[model samples]
Target chain A: MSGGSGTRNTNTEPWGSFDDHLIQGSGAAVIDMENMDDTSGSSFEDMGEMHQRMKEEEEVTAEAAATDDDTHDDGEFLGMKGLKGQLGRQVADEVWQAGKRQASRAFNLYANIDILRPYFDVEPVQVRSRLIESLIPVRMINFPQKIAGELYGPLMLVFTLVAILLHGMKTSDTVIREGTLMGTAIGTCFGYWLGVSSFIYFLAYLVNAQITMLQMLSLLGYGLFGHCVVLLITYNIHFHFLFYVLWLLIGGLSTLRMVAALLSRTVGQTPRLLLCGTLSLLHMLFLLYLHFNYHKIVEGLLDSLDGPHMAPMQRVARDVAELTLNASVRSLGVTLRAQ
Target chain B: PDWFHWTRTSFTEASRPFAGLSDVSISEDIPVEGDISVPVGSSRRDEEFSTLDEPVKETILRDLRAVGNKFIHVLYPKRSSALLRDWDLWGPLLLCVTLALLLQGGAADNDDQGGPQFAEVFVIVWFGSIIITLNSKLLGGTISFFQSLCVLGYCIMPLTVAMIVCRLVLLGSSGTVSFAVRLIVVTASFGWSTFASTAFLADSQPPNRKALVVYPVFLFYFVIGWMVLTFSPSQ
Candidate 1:
C-alpha cells in the first residue's frame, strides 16, 4: 500500500495530525519524491535537484511555523504527537520480532532434540545453549525451576531405595513377613519418588510452556499411578510385571507426546496441561484400582485357604489337637478297664 | 671306760625299748576303719586335732574357696548379673523355649512327603529370625519395632545358611559329583538371600513406630498369601 493511503487510513481517527507526522518520520521521503517525480515531468538527471528543493521548502515551512506563535501551536503539537506514535510503532515491531525469533528458536531446538538429530547444520550444543538462554529470561522468574531443583535429589534417593527394596522382595524366599516389609518399603519409596518427580516435571514443562501452576500440580497429582504400580509389583510380581512393562511404554509415549505438543505450539499451555493431567489421572486411577483389588484378592485367597482347604498352619494346629484328644481317650480307656 | 660304756649302752637300750613300745602301741591303736592314731610316748607329745597348728590348713581352705568362687564366676560372669537382676534366668530360658517351640511347629508343618517345602521352610525361618531379633533388641532394652524388623530381615543370612545345610542333609548326593553340586547350589542360594535381605533393610526407611508394626504385619500376610497362591506347586 502507498504511504499516503496508509496515512489516510490512520488519519481518519482522532489522531490525524499524529498519523501524518508518523508517516513522514518513517520512509515517507521516498514516497514523496516518487509522487513529485510523477507530477513534475522531471528527468532522472534532475531528481537530486528536485529532492534538495523539496527538503529546503519543508525545513523553511517547519521553521516559519516554529517562529510564529499563532501558527506554531498546531504544527508543534502535531509534530510531537507524530514522533511519539512513530517511536511506539518502532518499539512494538522490535518486541514482535524478538518474540518470533525466540519462539522459532525454541521450536527448532526441541524438534531437533526430540528426534535425536540436528535439523540443520548448527551444532546441537550451540543450539541448546541459545535456546536455554532464551528460555532463562522467561523461566528464571518462575517457580518451576526452583521446585525442580529442590526435588531432584530427594526423587533420586527415593527411586534408588525403591529399586533396592523391589529387588530384595522379588529375591526373598520368605514371602511372608520379610517379603512384605521389603515390598512396602519399595512401594513407599516408589510412591514418594514418583510423586515428587511428576510434580517437578509437570511444573517445569507447564511453566516453560506458560501454563497455570495449579493445573501443572493437578497433572502431577496423577503420578499416583506410578506409586500404585510400585505397590502392585511388590505384592504380585506375576501380574505387576506385565503392568510394569505397560506402564513404562505409556510413560515413554506420554513423554514423547509432551515434547511433541510443546514443539508444535498447536495447543497452548492450558490445553496441554489439561490433556497431560487427564491422562495421568486416568492411569493413576487404574493403577490404584489394580493395587487395591490385588490386595483384596490376596486376602480372599488367604480366607479361602482358612475356610475349608486348611492352610498349613491350621492343619498343624488341628493335627496337634487331634493327637492330644486321642491320647487322652486311650488313657481313659486304660483306666476304665483297670477299674 | 667301763662306766662310760655302760652309760652309752643304757641310753641306747632305753631309746630302743621306748621306740619298740611306741611302735607296738601305734599298731594296737590302728582302727579297722583305716584311721591311724599316733601313740603317746615318753620321748614326745602328741597334739589333738583341734589343738594342731599347721600352716597348710588355712592356706588349703582359702585356696579351695577362691577356686570355687572363680569357677562359679566363670560359669556366670558379672555382666550376666545385670541380665539376671532384671528377671530370673528361667524367664529368658522360657522365652527361648517358647521361640524354639514356635519354630519347631512351623518347621514340622513345612516337612513335605517328598522333601522339605522350601517356601514354607523359608517362611518359618523368617518368622523365627524376626522373633529372635526382636527378643534380642528387647533384651538389650530397646523396643524399636522397625529396627527389629530390619535386623531380623538382615539376620536372615544365618537362617538361609541353615536352610542350605538342611537341604544338603535331607537331599543326599544323587550321581557322581552330585553332592558337591548340591552343596554349591545351596551355598549360592543362601548367599543370595543374605545379600538380598541386607540390601533390602539398608534401603528401608527408618521406622515410625506407630505405623510400622500393624501395617507391616497386614502387608506380610497379604503378600505371603498372594505369593503362595501364585507360585505354589499345587496352584
Candidate 2:
C-alpha cells in the first residue's frame, strides 16, 4: 500500500491519469467493502464473491501476477493494481484492445459474405487464410458470427433483411410496400436474436457458467444468422418441412456445442446439457413459430405488396399441404373417437 | 518442407498426361497402367485404397479395412484415436458420391434438376474443400489439404445417415414423427460432424484464432450437413 502511494507520487507517463483514477476506484471499493451492510444487488459483495471464485482457481490467482496469458484478461478484472501496485488498468486495457482486434478480424472474415477467399494464400497470418472460398452454401453457417458487434451484426442484419425483401418481393403480389417488409424484417431479426442471446446469457448465468454476458451475446448473435437463413429458405420455398428439421438438428447442435465449449470448464455436464437442450428447443420452437405465422405476420402488414403472387401450381402445392394436415388431424380425431 | 515437396510432387503428377485412356488392369505386372488418373489434390501420402506403385490387390484389401475403420468411426465417433489411425480419401469421395445421389433422389420428384449430377457435386465439394483446406493451411493446421478434405469427407458420414433418415422419414411419415426422427438424426450427426471435424482439425492456434478457424470449419461441415439432412422430396 505504501509502495502504491510512492508510485502514484512518482507517476510521470500518460497512463498516470488512469493510474490515479484506478487508485481512487480501488480505494472507494475497499471503503465500500468495509462499510457496506447486506444489500440486494450489492456490488461489493459481488466483488468479494468474484474474488473468492478467482482465488478458488489457483491458476487464475497465479495468473494475476503474470500478464502473459491473454484469455484471462476477460471474465474478471481483480480491481487489483499492477503487480507493482502502481500500474493501472491501462495496461490491461491495451491487452484487451489487442485481443478484441484479433477477435474482430476473425469474426469479420467469417461474418462478411462479400469477402472472397483468394486462390492461394499470400498472407502469412492464419486469420488471412480463413478467407478461402467455395460456392458452397456451407459458408452460410458462419453468417451468424457477424453478431460479434461492430459492423458484423449490422451488415448481416442488412443482408438478412435484403434476402427477406427479395423473397417477399418475388413471392408476394403487393406486400412489397418498400419499407414495410424491411421494417418487419429488421424488427423480427433483431428481436429474435437479441432475445435469444439474452435468454442464453440468462440460462448460462443460472448454470454458473464461467462466461460474460457480452460473450454469450456474441455467441448467440453469431448462431442466430443460421436460424435466419432457415427462416428465409422456409419463407421463399414452397415447403419448409425439410428445412425446419435441418435447422432443428444443425441449429440445436451448433448452439449447444458452442455454448458448452465456451463454458466447458466452468459448468458441469448435466446442467450444461440441460441449458443447451432448453436453448435448442426454444430456438426450434422459434423457427417453427416463425414458419407457422410467417404469412400471417408478414402478410398482415398490408401495403402495395399484399396481393397474390404465388403461381397457380404453387397454390396447388399449398392446398396439398393443407389437405395432408387436415387428413392427419381427422385421422387423430377418429382415433380419439374409437378410443 | 517435405510436406510441401510431397504436395508439389502430387500436383505435378496429377497434371501429367497418362498414355492409355483405356480401362487397363492395375496389377503391378502391367506397369503402363501405373500412370493412370487420380483424384485432383490427392497426394502420394493420400493413397486412399491403393497406390499405383503398391501391390494393387493387397493395397485394395488394406484400403477396404481402412475404410471400414473410418466408417466405424462414424458410428463410434468417440473412438477418434482408432478411427483417424488411417485417413484416406476414397471413403470421402465415395461419401460425396453417395450424398450427391441421395440429394438427387431427394430432389428427384421436384422437376428442378434430375438425377445425381456428379460434376456439380464434385465442383461444389472441390470448391468448399479448397476454401477450408486453405484456411486450415493458413491457420497452421497440421492436416494436409487432401487429408483435411478426406477427414471432412469422412465427417459427412453422420450427414449421410441423417440424409437417409430424412428420405425414409419423408417417405413413410409426416409431421411430428418425421420432425422427431429428423431432429434426432440431424442433431446427433451435426454434433458428430462438428465434434469429429474439430477434433480432426484442432491446431495449436492461439485460443482466439483457434475459434476463428474452428468456428468456420464447424460451419463448413454444418452447412454441408444441413444440405445433406434437408435435401428431401419437396413437401
Candidate 3:
C-alpha cells in the first residue's frame, strides 16, 4: 500500500502552486526502495526501545523489593519527602517543621489507595464492634485502641438513620413535610457531624490538645451509632414517659460517648471538663431537637426554631394532644389487661 | 442546509403523530429541492457559517425549545442521552424556585415564623444537586459536572409537580383523605424523578458502580419528595 501511494504521489501534479517543493520529486521506483529501507530501520529502533523498557522494568522491580523490607518501619508515608531524612536538617523551628511535615503529608496524599482504604474498606464486623464499643459511653484507659474510626459505617449510619426517621415520622401524625423533613434530618445529621466536629477540633486546638480533624470526625461518626440507638428506642417505645426515660438514658449515653471521645484528647482537667460539659449540652440539645421534631410531641418547639411563636390556643392544643396521647396509652393498657 | 434539515426534522418530530408523514415528505422534498434549487443554493452558500452568526432571537428561541424538549423527555423518560446532550440549567432553576416558593409559602406565613425558609429550600435543591453531581464524578461517571446537574435538576420537575399537588390538597382540607392523596402524589413523583434521572444518567456511570451513582440521585429526589409530601401550611 505504501509503495503504491509513493508511486501515485510521484505521478500526481500539485493542485495549487508548484514552486514550493519541486526539488523533492523523484522516480517512483527509487522512492519505493527508500520506503522499504526506512521500514527495516524502524524495526531495529523498535528492538532497541523494547530492550530499554525491559531494563527500566527490572530496575523498578528491584526498587520495589528494596522498599518492601522497610514497609513496617517507615509506614505508609515512607515515600513522603519532608518526613524522611530530617534527623539533622533544620529548615526552621519545630512548629514550622511540624507544619511542613503535615503539608508534605497532605501534598503527598493524592489518589492514594492506602490512605483512603480505611475510610471505605469497612467490614460488617468492624462496624458491629464499633457500635458495641460506642454503646459503652466512656473508655478512659484503652480509649484510643478500642473503636476504630471509619467513614463507611458512619455514612451508612447517617443514611439508615435518615430513612428510619423519615419512615418513623411519616408513620406518626406529624404535620411537617417528610421530604423537607428528610432534607432537614440529613442536614441535621451531617451538619451536626461536620459542625460539631469542627467546633470540638477548634476547641482542642485552642487548648493545645493532640488530635487531627479526621480523628475527631471518625470519633464523632462512631458516636452517632449511640444516637441511632436512642432514636430507634424512642421511635419504638411509644409511651411518653418511656420516651423521656429512654431519651434520658440512651440520649445521655450517646452524649457521654461524644463527651468522652472529645474529652480523652484534651490535656488538662479544665479543658476536659469544659469539652465534656459543652459536648453533653450539644448532644442533649440535638436529642431535644430530634424528639420534638420527629415524635410529633410538640410542633411548637420545632416551629420556634424558625417559625413564629405558638399561638395561645396552639399551646393549649399541644397540651391537650399530650394528655390525649397519655390517655390513649392508659386505655390500651386497660384493654390489654381485660383481654 | 444541514441546519435547516435538522430544524425541519426536529419541528416535524415535535408535532406528535405527524412524524411518520413528515419523514416520508422529507425524503420526497429532497428530490423536489433538486428541481427547484434556489433555497438549496442559498443554504449551501451559508453552510460555512456557525451558530455564532445566528440571530439572538433565534438563539434564545432555540435554547427555549431545547429546555422544553428536556421537560418532555423528563415527563416520559427513556434511556436516551440524545436530549440530555444539549443540557441546560433553566428548567432545573425554574422547578427549584417554584418548589422552594411553594415550600416557603407553606412554612413562612408569619414574618417571625422560622420554618423551611425560601433560601433553605433553594440551597438544598442546588446544593444537593451539586453534591450528587460531585459524587457521580468521584464514582468515575463519564458525564460532565453540569450535565449531571442538569439531569438531576431537570428530574426535579416531577417532585415539584407533586409539591404543587400537595399544596393544593392541603388547601382544600388537612384531613386523612388529603394526607393519603398527598402521599400518593409524592410517592409517584418520587419514583418518576428517580426513574427519569437514572434513565438519563445510568449510561454515563461505570457499569459496576452504577448503583453507587444512582443511590445518591435517589436520596436527592427522595429528600425533595419528602419535603413535598410533609409540607403543611403553618397556621
Candidate No. with top lDDT: 3
Per-residue accuracy of model 1 over A1-339 as CA lDDT, tens digit each: 122221121111222234333434444411221121111111321334444445545555554454465334545566667867656655665576557545544554222332322121223243334323221223122233311112112222243344334433433332333334444555655554465445545655654554344333322332332343354343433343455565655443433333333333324567556555654554445444433343343345546745866453222111121112222144554565577
- The model with the greatest DockQ is 3
RMSD of each: 44.1, 24.6, 18.3
**lDDT tens digits, residues B1-235, model 1?**
3433333333344223233333232233544343333332412333333334657878678646644443333233332222111112222233233323323323223333222233333544365445433322222212223333433333233333343353444356344355445445444544443443333232222243222222233233233322222222211
DockQ, Cα level, model 1? 0.00
Q: Model 3: residues >4 Å from true position, as ranges?
A: A1-211, A232-238, A248-339, B1-49, B52-57, B111-116, B138-142, B167-174, B202-215, B232-235
Candidate 3: which docking quality band? incorrect
Report the C-alpha lDDT of model 2 over B98-179, residue by residue, as the tens digit. Answer: 8777776343232533532344455546656766666655544434345567667888788877888788888897677786
Estimate the TM-score of every prediction: 0.21, 0.37, 0.54
Q: In model 2 chain B, which range of ten residues has the least summed lDDT?
A: B12-21
Docking class of 1: incorrect
Tens-digit lDDT string for candidate 3 (B1-235): 4544453344333224233445443444454322322232344545676788789999899888888888999999988775555667898898888887788856423454445467667876887788677656555455655677888889999988888888888889997789789888899999999999998888776576666667667877776776677677877
Ranking by DockQ: 3, 2, 1
Rank all candidate structures by their lDDT, best first, as comma-separated numbers.
Answer: 3, 2, 1
The Cα local distance difference test for each model comes to 0.36, 0.51, 0.62
**Model 2, A1-339: lDDT tens per residue?**
211221121122222233333444433211111111211122333445444433334443454445545436632454654444324454765687567545444544332321322221223243232221100123232223222222233223334443454344334323222234445655676687677667777776777865666556545555555565665655554344666576766555555545444445344677757776777676667666555555455554552353566322221222125212222245664565576
Candidate 3, backbone clash total: 13
